[model samples]
Target: MTAAAPPRRTGPVRSEGVRLAILEATARQFAARGYDHLTIEGIAAEAAVGKQTIYRWWGSKSALVAECLVEGMLLPHRLAPPDTGDIRADLTAWVDAVLTLLAEPQGETLLRSIIAAAAENADIGRRIRESLAGSESIVGRLEASIGTAPNLTPGAPFEELSETLVGAIVLRALSRAPREPGDAARIVAAVLGPA
Candidate 1:
């Protein structure tokens, strides 16, 4: 052969590069195949990395899935709630944002996959809760704005309300049913009431 195959092109890849590659591959696979169907081997193959690389970084398929869900689906922490000082407007806008995300095909698929994964796997469920908590800047903002109004009674737990609203949107999206814009507004009104 000519010059020993050009010296083999060796040198270890950067850890960050490998991590990003694995994450990207996992996300694409999860979006295409859902959690139940995804495999570490498949992800490794898609990423062009060794199986050990993934295992070393994420520890398990469920862990990888959890990280993928957090990295891909959830909004950034910095955005938080609108805080217009009006709970109605804030809740309405939050609901609208959630609904809009759920309406997207990728977003809907991701939500269903994560929810299903969480239901079946306790580890995944815990990770999902943690991720949701971290991603719920809006909830914290809303709670802070509400303060200790005696009549309000702290309101229905914002986390529970968020789950319900998002769950409803996911169900509607998956069922291919028409989503009524008024429905989100109504839910916000019911949960937060008039300001």
Candidate 2:
């Protein structure tokens, strides 16, 4: 019988390094080309890794982009939505936090890229929603803290209200309109209503 060839080695350290490099490359690509035009090969080239490596780690371009967005942009701002036993204060804080992020250049670029991606690609859109909107990770914590305020039920209406508020901020950013602090505060007040 012929001797079997040695199995390829994929050490954990190297695997993690490749993952990090891919994420960095994906960020740059997304920033430069937007999500619609980004390719796995391009990311691999930018990261100095093989396309197969990216495929093995992330499975698809959408997955990679989602991970990159979450890890780089969303995770850093992961506020649990201030409870403080006051719904208005907690929501106001949350809105302020989001508005502050929207004011930053990096935040603007990332949000635009995500919106564009979501518009043009259904898979990417779903992934974006799952990463940012669907998961109770951020909003759930906020809801728990609020503990059933007057209008803010833990239901569809509340979700829609939250979406509307955040979506307005994102739309303003995309439109190149100024995001005034007062405007964000107004949105919060409108949603929560008369603390």
Q: What TM-score does each of the candidates earn? A: 0.61, 0.63
Q: Give residue 113's lDDT in candidate 2 (0 to 100).
A: 59
Q: For every model in order, what is the number of clashing pairs?
A: 0, 0
Count of clashes in candidate 1: 0
RMSD of each: 10.6, 7.2
lDDT of 1: 0.65
Which ten contiguous residues of candidate 1 have the minimum total lDDT? 72-81
> For candidate 2, which ten residues in a row score worst on lDDT?
133-142
Off by over 4 Å in 2: 1-21, 24-47, 51-65, 71-75, 78-85, 132-138, 145-148, 154-156
lDDT of 1 at 194: 44
- Residues 161-195, candidate 1, lDDT per residue (tens digit)? 55655566566677866678586687666555544
All models: lDDT?
0.65, 0.66
Model 2 C-alpha lDDT per residue in residues 1-195, reported as the tens digit of each score: 999999977653446777888898887877777666889989899999988778776656766766677565433444346556665666667777767776776556566656655665677776655544433443554456444456665563555666666677677777877766477567777766654
